[model samples]
Target: MNSHSSDKKGILRRLRRIQGQVSGLERMVEDDSYCIDVLTQISAATAALQACALALLDDHLHCCVADAVTRGGDAAREKVDEASQAIARLVRS
Candidate 1:
């Protein structure tokens, strides 16, 4: 496969793992686990999600966003705005 497809597959794998972590955290809460333990699991899940998001953002900046900028036009400006808004949302979370 091409490199883009390979990167998407890897990202999907990480997302699935994060999904499992979230499920496990739900189970922990259902089991009435200690407050600190539950919070810790939540923290871990959040970190995993953030890591995946950051990885995707890095890839976009390096490839898609870079290409858009190189093209140089309204489309490039739009892409930059879109990417900036996305990063802002991610940071807010």
Candidate 2:
């Protein structure tokens, strides 16, 4: 199974909820909702997305990347490099 398959349903559920929040934000803008209220929802949606991303990153480190390292040799070294690049990219973003 894929490393994230176990949490797929839960992750998808969270994504769908975030999608709904975004849709609501669109409606809020269309309806001219208060600025603070819309901003609050936007902040919440951002937090939700960030949370999902962190969870997937954690799973990748613990599963695929860890397994690659255990395999040893060049492949392990490559996986480490790949993980480091991914982390750097995430931090930069």
**lDDT of every predicted structure (CA atoms):** 0.86, 0.85
Best candidate (score: lDDT): 1
Q: Each prediction's Cα RMSD?
A: 2.6, 2.0
The sequence of per-residue lDDT tens digits that candidate 2 reaches over residues 1-93 is 274555878888889999999999999999999999999999999899888877777777788778888998888888789878878877776
TM-score winner among the candidates?
Answer: 1
Clashes of 1: 0
In TM-score terms, candidate 2 sits at: 0.85
Tens digits of lDDT, candidate 1, 1-93: 226632888888998999999899889889998999989988998998999888888888877778889999997998899889989999899
Locate the minimum summed-lDDT window of 10 residues in model 2.
Answer: 1-10
| Candidate 2 ranges with C-alpha deviation above 4 Å | 1-4
> What's model 2's lDDT at 32?
100
